[model samples]
Every structure is written in C-alpha cells, then in structure tokens.
Target: MTLRTATAGDLTAIMDLERTSFPTDAWSEPMMQSELASPHGRYLVDVEAGRVIGYGGVRAVQGSADADIQTIALAEAARGRGRGRTLLRALLEVARERGAREMFLEVRADNPVATALYASEGFVEIGRRPRYYQPDDVDAVIMTLDLVAWAAHRAADGTALDAGACS
Candidate 1:
C-alpha cells in the first residue's frame, strides 16, 4: 500500500471508504471537498490496487501551531492490516513538520480499536465529552499527544511507532 497527500481527484474514493468504514458518521462529499481546499487542512489517503483503502484529515491552526485530527478511517476490507495506524502516524508527522506542538482528537468511548490506537501512539486521555458522538449518542473521549515526545520516542526507536503495539 502507498500513502500520499490527497487531492480533489481522490474525493470519490475517499467518500467511498468513509461510507464503508463509518456508515453512521460518514463525511459528506462536499465536506471532504472543502477540506481538500482548506489552506490550514490536510487530507491523506492510502492506496492499494489503485483504490483508496484508508484516509485521514487534520487541520493545523497557523498562528497557534495547534492541530486537530478531524477524522481517520479505513475501508472494511482494509482493517487489521495496520493501515489505520500508518495513516495516523503520517498525519502526525505532517502536523509536526507544519510546526504543531500538540495534537488532539475525540473518539467514541466504546470504539476500542480507535481508542487503543490513539493510546498506543502516545496519546493520553485528557477528558471526555458526554454524548459527544451524537449520531449514536456515544460519549466522546478526548485524547492528546505531545508531538515532541512522540517524535523523540520514534527517533529513539529508529522509526515511527508500530501500530501493532497499539494498546
């Protein structure tokens, strides 16, 4: 699989992946189109067999050097192959290079896979927003990671954190 920065051309496949990975909370086509055009945002995709198998979105606030992960998902057929973690690490690397010092995201409290992935990536549970996932009314758990530390760990380990070790 190959991961690359997304462009408008990748919108259709991205939406396709979103629909399958997040049936109840998929991002609309326009929502994705806008992100691809945003100056402060980035969208990335992992391609396999010429298809977008997984993707991630993030926004980096210019002045503050803060970044927030908007969403990350993998196609149903792409799960369990560590693609999700790879996409996340790539996004985080983009965040760090863009001068972001911190990163944050919200996940469903019951999404063990996501929560675990975030945790293993050096994210710490900071707090939660009760019933934040309105689509399903599931609580949202907030997690934060210190990019400096994360990078140091990755460097010390001689590579990016392995998704296999997630949670």
Candidate 2:
C-alpha cells in the first residue's frame, strides 16, 4: 500500500469510499471538491494496486494554533490493520507541520472502534455534542490532542512517527 497527497484526479475514488463509509452522512461531491480545493486543508489517499483504499484530511491554516481533523475513512477490507491509525497520524503530522499546537475531531458516540482509536492516539474526550449526527441521532464525541505532548511521548519512547512509512 502507498499513501500520498490527494488531487482532483482522485475525487471519484474518494467519493466512492466516502459514500460507502458514511452511507447516511456522506458529503456531496461538490462539498468534497471544495474541501480538496481549500487552501487550509491537506487531504491524503491510501492506494493499493493503483486503487484508493482509504482517505483522510485535516484543516489547518498556516501558523494557526489549532487544527481540525476533517475526516478519515477506510474500506471495510482495510480496517483493523492499522491503516486508519496510519492515515490519522499522517493527518496529525500535516497539522503539526502547519504550526498547529493542538488537534481536534468529532467521532460518533456509538462508534467504539473509532472512539478507541482516537483515545489511543493521546486524544482526550473534551466534550460532547448531543445528537450531533443527524438522522441517526447519535451524539458526537469531541476529542482533542496536544501536539507538543504527543511528540514528546513519541520521542521518549524512541518510536519514530514517520508518516511516509509504507509498513
């Protein structure tokens, strides 16, 4: 598998995954196109055999003190293999590179797997937005991570957080 920055050419594949991953709340193609064209966003696609298997993005204006994880999704076959974690770390790194001191995201309250993934990445539950997910009426669990502390912990453990690592 390979991960790289996303481009307009990958929009079709991305939309496919987005619709499949979030069947009820998928962003429209126009919205996704706008996101890809946004100056404050950095999006990435994970590919295998020239096919996109996962994608994610972060919104971080240059010199900003904080960033938001816009979205992250992987094909069902790509889950539970650390691919989501890899995509997440890459998005976080992009945010950090853009001078963000902290990162924030919202996950569905009913999705334990996603919630656990964020928690394992040093993100703490800061608050909640009741009934934030429409149609399903699921709450949104807001989480935040301190980039400086996260980097320090990684350094202390001697584990390099290389976003480009293929394995």
Candidate 3:
C-alpha cells in the first residue's frame, strides 16, 4: 500500500470508499471538494496497485493548539490490515507538525473497531452526542488525544512516530 497526500483527482475514488464505509451519512461531493480545497485541512489517500483504497484527513490551522480529525475510511477489502491505524497516525503527525497540541475526533457509537483504534492510540472519551449520526440515529463518541503526551509515550517505548512510513 502506498499512502500520499490526496489530490482533487482522487475525489472520485475517495467518494466511492466514503459512501461504502458510511452509507448512512457519507459526505456530499461538494463538501468533500471544499475540504480537499481547504487550506486548513490535510488529506491522504492510500493506494494499492494504482487504485485508491483508503483515505483520511485532518483539519489543523497553522499555530493552532488543537486539530480535528476530519475522517478516515478504508475499502472493505482493505480492513483489518493496520492500514486504518497507519492513516490515523499520519493524520496525527500532520496535526502535530502544524502546531496542534491536541487532536479530536468523533466516531459512530456503533462502530467498535474504529472506537478501539482511537482508544489504542491514547484517545480518551470526553463526551458523546446523542443521535449525532443521522438516518441510522447512532450516537457519536467524542474522543481527544494529547499530542505531547502521546509523543512522549512513543519515545519512551523507543517507537519512532514517522508519518512518512506510510508514504
């Protein structure tokens, strides 16, 4: 798998996976287009055999103390291979490089795999939004991570956090 900065040209592929992963509340094309064009957002696509299979994004303004995880999705066939974790770590690194001290994200309450991934990354649940996901009416799990502490922990374990590893 090859992960790299996403371009507008990858929109169609990204949307395909996005809709498949989040059928109940997939982002609209216009909204996704605006996100890809936003200065505050950094998106990445995972490609395999020249086909886009996964994608994720983070919104971090320069000099900001906090950032938001915009989204992360992998094609059904690509699940359970640590690709999602790789995409997530890359996004966190991007936010940290942009001067973010904390990272925040919301996951569907019904999605245990995603919630577990975030939790394993040191994200702690801070709150929840009832029925935040429409159509499905699933609750949203709000989680946050302190980048400083996370980096320190990784260093202590002698594990280098290299976003480029995915690239």
List the candidates' TM-scores in order: 0.91, 0.95, 0.96
Clashing pairs in 2: none
For 69-149, candidate 1 gives per-residue lDDT tens digits of 999989777888888888899888778877898999999998999999999999999998998875888889999999888
lDDT, model 3: 0.92
Q: What is the lDDT of residue 21 in candidate 2?
A: 96
Cα lDDT, all candidates: 0.84, 0.91, 0.92
Candidate 2 lDDT by residue in tens digits, 1-167? 68898999999999999999999999999999999999999899999898999999999999999999999999999999999988898888888778899999999999999999999999999999999998899999999999989878877998646654432
Q: For this target, which candidate reaches the highest lDDT against the unseen true structure? A: 3
TM-score, structure 3 vs. true: 0.96
Better of 1 and 3 by TM-score: 3
User: What is the descending TM-score order?
Assistant: 3, 2, 1
For TM-score, the strongest prediction is 3
Superior candidate under TM-score, 2 versus 3: 3
C-alpha lDDT (0 to 100) for residue 122 of candidate 2: 96
